[model samples]
Target: MAYIRPLANGNFRADVRLKGITKNKTFSTEKLAQTWADSIERNIKAIPLMSSAQLLEITEADIESMGGEELFKQLGIDLFAIRHCAKLEAINALSKKELLQLTPQEIERMGGADLFIKAGKRIRYKTFREVCDEYLSRWGKKDYKGQMQRVDYWCQFFGDRIMTDIDIFDLREHVDDMIDAGDRATTINRKKAVLSSVYKFALSRGYVDENLVRSVVVDDDTKRRDRVLSDQERQRLIKACQVSHWDKLYLLVLMAMTTGARKGELMSLRWNDINFKDGTAFLGDTKNGTSRELYLALVVIAELKCHQEIGTGLIFPSLELPEQPMDFRAAWRNALKAANISDKDVLNTDGSVKLERFTFHCLRHGFCSALSDAGKEINQIAKLAGHKSIQTTMRYIHQGRDQKRQIVNELAQAFNL
Candidate 1:
């Protein structure tokens, strides 16, 4: 309701308030006090009246008639928004013929004229890290195993920086730093790909003008060709596994190497996901939530059958969590000790002998390599590996065993062996 009172100097003062404006703060409008009071009464009496703001929509003529801030003070409206209204009122006073003489910056300073900026335009200034977080928050549960792990990587790198503040030069520095550290082209490219995804998401949301990361070129030649283990290395790893203390660890390694399932998929498995009689395991929710069935290798089946227990649901239950698989690090360290391998030294599929810098994922690679050696088609290999595209599976097709053997035999034949 609004009320007008006579002030001490014969001036009129208006007091207006809106009910249900907020939990406590009341809305005030002395400039349209009379209209507001009538509207409040109409609202209380179940009658509709034109809104006070609509009725008092300021016009060019109204501004000159009202004159200045003193006229506003006389009306008893003291809000800061009135300053904006006055500023606009003054700008609208400009004659149309004289408006063209103003500079672009000067015209922009007239706030009312800038209202058309957001129309049909996307805002894109978010940082790579911010976009990554927003992406994860909205879609993390549906992301692939590789993507879920990269969250820590990005957060560690640039979580504190604002998205708008980052530019191509900043990305170039980060990429150069990675390259200088002897990181392989594949590793550097993967990080760059993540950045590209962030930009793509930002583009969709109108946060970026362009994907600057895509414009910069990465050294694609630095990709490491997949190198499979030699027959002797595979044999040694199998031999070491026979004497391993954690039998499940050996089984986990063997399953990964044979089936090419990712570490997370293997670790998340339960007895219910497997079928011993049919010799198959049904993965209910893969990277894309599509169920997939894998043929259990004879070797993997033998390991599972030998260690089968009736105590729990998890196929690979942890010592601590019981319902969960133990952290691979604990068993991985032990495996390394048994195989006499360091972090820099790669293990064969069975985890024996120091070959190179390959880690757990190399086991999956070993599986695809063996499959390719056995004459499996590229598409079949991709399906088995759970790759969305054959291009991803291509990296796993290491030089086959037959190919390597042929090379060795050719050398011997060339020497007249």
Candidate 2:
């Protein structure tokens, strides 16, 4: 039963009282109050008639007939909860050993690992370590060593745990651990991405319910490295590289600055990859899994001609091991020291970088930033940098304060202000 009365505040009050159920609300008008009372009464009357069995059998049309999900929620009738309970009852009827004996195909036919999780049941799924190994075996060719190392680190903590058992909270704890260990945001995000990939692979094979790693949040604001090299710094760095102990350091640095190619891409270069006539280099195996052409400036081409290797071997092969890429970390650090562009001031007491430091990667940043400052189109910059996304190219572009002011001044002139 329902009733409506006019309140002292010039509003109408509705009261709906049914079998052990009571609801009341005030509305601005009597018609509104009556309508709300009728809705409540209908919802309250409809909930009791919906048993768990009926809830399990409820279709979209039946829910619409009952006034939709909001009405059921208003009457404290959780249709999902009722269905989940029915699922639990069905799962509970099956023995644990029987469930464990079911194959991945059978489990998938029973509504996937997601349904099992909702029904509070555990099935025999592969362990985290096993899934990691399987994932590596199938999809680790692109970055085998790096992905293997990351997987090993994850296995150290979650190797014994079932893939289905690892929830978002567990993943969050791992992220916190990485943060505590002084890992950079970019590094942490990369590790998280690897784990997320594993979870996605598991999800495809019906080993887990969801990719919980998608929920793990890391601070990404610090991921953008805006260390664009100044003209003076570039000059100094080039001069330093020219006099470095490593004879090939100057050419490597020159190509890195001119073409904005990654250290790996440059190091993996071969004699045949370069076309001297066109003054271009073909990067077949780029980071984005696509090939791109890098146009060489005349100076770069001249320098390349001087150090050109004859065969199809790597342009910058290792000195000791001809088949391997050179380990130039010491040479790179020495060049930085000679250029007086050291990160010593930004280093912590334990010699860890406390702030963004100028690295060889910064040369790429400088390349994009210089193009942006020169009024080049973003698409052109992204194409030259081989960035698959314009947003990524945007991160690399760090315009100087003078360039910003000049842009505004140009805008003012155009407006005749």
Candidate 3:
């Protein structure tokens, strides 16, 4: 309802009151005052008179637009009390046999399983496998095979177990099992990280109350690798790659050794990423999500030119598929054998790695180490290796014994003592 009245100053005032909400305004003309009052009254009446249960559906913005919290209080609505009563109602409703028969979708529409749990209802939670499937489906990254493998291993271990049931104790047992099976600290930590990521996804979707993986501690006792190829080893490895069965293996190893690019980064490259005239390669996709440029050596550029394809497809496309990146694991192992770079110091009877041996990654280490040995600045090495920190670069920069001895001798000479 609204009332319009004339003021002594020849202006008009309008007052609108409805459902305990009141708003008043002054207008220059009686007609304007009447229009304003009518508008206000209509707007106030337009707001539906929601029940206490339905009031929970109103967002803060909706409340704000409808004259704020004070207006709701004036209308005999207490948000806090409503929420408390709604929780009780929801709990009581869940106890009904008819409500228990509701589909999962209906239950979610009413309020998620969390709501029923608060009501003291023991609901069937999603299995670990179901959670993994959902998590993988939502994964948007270009590379997820390694992550998928880790998730698969977890699903196999925790088969059919509900996510809420796998607590810190189960995670600890998993870690112990891995340790007993001779899994390295690094491997165990990697698996734990993957599980932690899954739990984080589950947490966001309200599948779990907490990430139990956070409570499980795994010791990372594995030492940082300082292995770098010697000059002779580098030569042998290059020659071995050159004569390998896979034609692309040579160029791949060369690019990896010279540019210090990770295996995935190089393998994902397309022909368009290279610039023959500038002797440069543009890496738009990298591990750190930062774009970088790799200056190609003349030898590498020459090899690339020779291997250049007709289209802008992958530089190292699979020979069979021609659309996917080539898998050169077997070829790489063969090259390592040919170069006499043993994968382990003392191989097991089953030919498994008992001790760490030289790997393709050592080529990257060799590149950084070589640059550091040549007196390059730490910052320069970091930029070349696309390392976000100089500390990471330092880990890869292992100087030979002779270089260390020479530096000591030079320091002593300078002291003249």
Candidate 4:
């Protein structure tokens, strides 16, 4: 029996079960999955009889699939192609798309034509390290390289073994060891996240039957930091930033407090993005692909104009490389120290540097919190913070991968009952 199941993300899965062997295929459309299901079930049943009618159906589908319907029509065998399949028994299990590429003679050998493509999953016999290396080769960015370091343990742990041989138990044990090692919850999560991406690629390429990444869970019990700056803290921080008015970090902190934008988005901004006339800051290249036009506070506009005259490109250009955005870490810490903000790299009993109460992202939380404290509606806060429901939208557009980024909803944006 074959049946169609709808996935949460509006995709569909077709499952075929017969003779105790079950195969499942996913499709973006229910119709496509159903068509696949129908075809697979029909082929499975019609194997021995291999009716002429079925062969005609297969040939016609192949002609269409090959995207040569017009060419087939010109040959006039468009209708007569099926009659030619006299002794055809097996098609080498060539998919319709593959069958279409074959020369009529080659296809005739399979359709009666011997285009010999070994049918079945071509197992690459890859090790976890090999798979991770292939996956890592796709990205050359420093951030990607940094993330690879976080999850590189997986390559070492699963070393020299077939990647698919790694079951959910192996992943679970690794995650458990990470938890036991006093690693931060975020660190553990990020390691698992990178591993998940590697496996998703494996699943797509038929290297694995399933993405075991879905079964791994984050069990770290650390409480999340929901640090929103108090009115006093905001005032002191503003004064500290003002002390060094010429510093770019002052402007960066002020912008984050006012806009509630992601740090990466703010860092990527150019002077052109902040429009004084329109009173809007256009955020292009957001983590989510959707761009937003943020309503800039007039005070922010006036402050930005102070630097616009001096700068030609990035509003926060790097000191050394005008092409890149500034990395504001040192300046941020200086301002925090001047403001007497308690969040510091403090020495713990274990003598390790443990982060304290607050960080730069807390400025963004403060922005949303201030809005909420002023009694703004929940949806309005979501709108101002650019946190509209984008989960399903991305899935619809990007399909299986790169669509499942779990953007954390800022605590301040959540409504309190």
Candidate 5:
């Protein structure tokens, strides 16, 4: 909990005291002030007690004595720039002599000592974690779990970094690190998108005048993986799952291939989401953030009916935690290996994974590929797949023999050849 008060200067002040750690920032708007208070308090709560104490006890004298640009570096806070004691005195936030005399705890109590020195370059800084906290609190309650997961990932990447210190290069390098570590582009882009959202949130609140995340280039071609299992590969995959005796994994892959549903959406399915008689299922949670009904294949309907006879709640409940969906990662990887879909995993002398990953999401690719090969129009495929945009489905329309033949026939008929 914290407090927000309007000052005579037409600015809003927000302050919170947590486990003796305090943050007090003033903003031009009440919304901004409240947001900062909420975010700072939340971050303080999330921090380990020792780390929070370290942050709280950084003395003003310790910083002022470091002098000019070297102050931030010595403090290990901001690498870019910082406001010096003279500037703080000019703003009447502190007197030069008084600021140098105050302890970090005293600075906190006085609502002075703008956190993070910017190497005398003066960065209007905000903590990445706090900004993410503000981002989630402002618009995240509706999608708490999903949004929090993104926030958590961003916190790990930046770790309470001064937002101004991170530029396009840093953002790109972080994403590249993920790529080199064998993360799928979608995963990397999703994390990048979270940062972008936070920057946008900050921009709206006047935390900073710029949104640096916008300048970071994402591969235009690789936003989503277009991988699909071939006919032989799909057959081998089923056989491998059968051999593994993982009944749930088999049904999970089958459902994904037949329905084009996302991993989370499929995981969320219950007997109630499916209507076996009507051969349809309703998705309450989807990437598009809307609910929609999708037609089910006869085979999928039959599978659901059989499973419903035995399964109680979740269609894919965890083996250990029945209320939650099973972690399909291990079995899925083993199946991929058994199907010979994966390349050699034994590291080379220099040490590198020999294969590209084909994740469970690829099963949705197989579903879309099947439709495109059957000559369904892009819009029809989009509707069936519950995609909010037909443009997204257009990516799946590969030009196979049927499509080529249609193009050839159209050209020939037009020329009367």
Candidate 6:
């Protein structure tokens, strides 16, 4: 058995002096030294020593069952002054503190799980934020707006907690809290999706054993909102866009309403991105890296070429720069106000809207609704909207012709179809 002894220098150490055993392993911290001694004692008890004539035969699993600490002890392994340093060359090596220091962005830059394993020094409880950064850096900035949004949502909902601290219960509570806070079921689900991805990342990296999100039970009391613009509302907003006098805003809206490119991709348009000769606009960066090709109708081409300012690199150059794209927030607000849409009444305190659910994104909805009303195919609609899936495009189509009947019934209710 190992015991603690005081040195002449007034420091204490663990001294395990046994015949035929390594001796006098000193420790600055008494508790650590004691742990070391106890581990060695346990190893000696488990494996009886044998003379040269007869060897103590033990299976590999027998040694492993004692755990890394006891197994190393039984083997009479003396780690360098820093125990972790010596184990760095062995299996099941990890550097907990060092792993904690790396940011998510750093992890993403290191690439996939294989790369992450190679790069991360063993760490304990790698925080969610670190994982988030790595996910973002790996996914890159442009394509991960939704993921970034979810990361922000989690950070705001629950301060900066370490990754290991997250449990299935915490995620369930967070979803419940969002529901109580009056978020749309869809929005809540989207946030859940982000959380799910984080858990998946943890599992893939061997950080967590299971995905907590998969076990989470979402509340069925959530509401589904896929509000699309009516023809009258569309016309009103169109008029508002025209009144703002940023013809590009009007054109941008028209493109979204006509082709259903996402607001960001549309606003990010440049002269070089347009191929007027072939009548197609090449979208370089999009949600999917498909590089969408949108056909420019005659009306779209006319609107674009009419105010085609010379020497401006951006098709929608900023009014301030006259050489760059303009900030669209002020323009968007004015257009909404002109349409008589009061944000206070429409949007909730938490930035979620109820009935007249509206945003720049609604223009794409307007386009989809127009197509659905016109009896377009799901695949055709998906391609036009640049949707990654037919189901995503079909969701905008709605069902049972109820919305379609409502359009006809509106006229009949007023004046007998």
Top-lDDT structure, candidate number: 2
TM for candidate 4 is 0.55
The full ranking of all candidates by TM-score, starting with the best, is 2, 5, 3, 1, 6, 4
Could you give candidate 3's per-residue lDDT for residues 1-417 as a string of tens digits? 899999999999998888777888899999988887776666566545676556888888977766667656665767755775765576575554545455566567767767777666765468889999999999887568867887999999885887766778888988998999998777889888989999999889877778998888877743456677777988898899999999989999999988999888898899989989999999998988789999999999999988897668999999899889998999999998999888755578998646557777777888899898999999999999999988888888989899999999999999995
Tell me the spans in candidate 2 whose CA falls farther than 4 Å from its real position.
1-92, 95-122, 137-150, 221-224, 344-355
Q: Residues 1-417, candidate 2, lDDT per residue (tens digit)? A: 999999899999998888766678899999999987887777677677776777778798977755577667766787766766655566678897778666666667666668887677878667799998989889735768977998898899999876666778888887898899988787899888878888899888767767888878887843455877778988999999999998989999999888889999999999999999999999998999899999999999999999888778988889999789999999999999888886433778898656557878888888888889888999999999999999989889988899899999999999999
Best by TM-score: 2
| lDDT of candidate 4 over 214-311, digit per residue (tens) | 89878653233445565687888888887763476667777888888889888888777776788988887676567898787777887787777534
Q: In model 5, where is the ten-residue run with the lowest total lDDT?
A: 115-124
lDDT of 1 by residue, 1-417 (tens): 556665565545555444422111123443454554455444433312334463257565654343333334334443234435656565657664444344334544665234213221122324457677777666645655567577558667766665555678888898888889998777888887877877787677655557888977886842364645567666666666666776677788788878899888888788777788988888876865677887898888988888776543788777788876777686676665566544464567888744556467778888898888877899999998899888888877887556889879989999999
Cα lDDT of model 4 overall?
0.67
- Kindly list the per-residue Cα lDDT of model 5 for residues 133-196, writing each as its tens digit: 8777778435788788877977887856666556678888887788899875566777878788
Candidate 6 versus the native: TM-score? 0.58
Q: Which regions of candidate 1 fall more than 4 Å away from where they truly are? A: 1-141, 144-162, 177-188, 216-223, 310-312, 333-356, 400-417
Measured by TM-score, how close is model 5 to the native structure?
Answer: 0.65
The lDDT of model 3 is 0.82
Error of 1 at 197 (Å): 1.9
Question: Global lDDT for candidate 2?
Answer: 0.83
> Which segments of candidate 5 are over 4 A away from where they belong?
1-89, 92-125, 218-225, 310-312, 343-357
What global local distance difference test value does model 5 have?
0.69
Ranking the candidates on lDDT from highest down gives 2, 3, 5, 6, 4, 1
Question: How much lDDT does each candidate structure score?
Answer: 0.66, 0.83, 0.82, 0.67, 0.69, 0.67
**What is the Cα-based TM-score of model 3?**
0.65
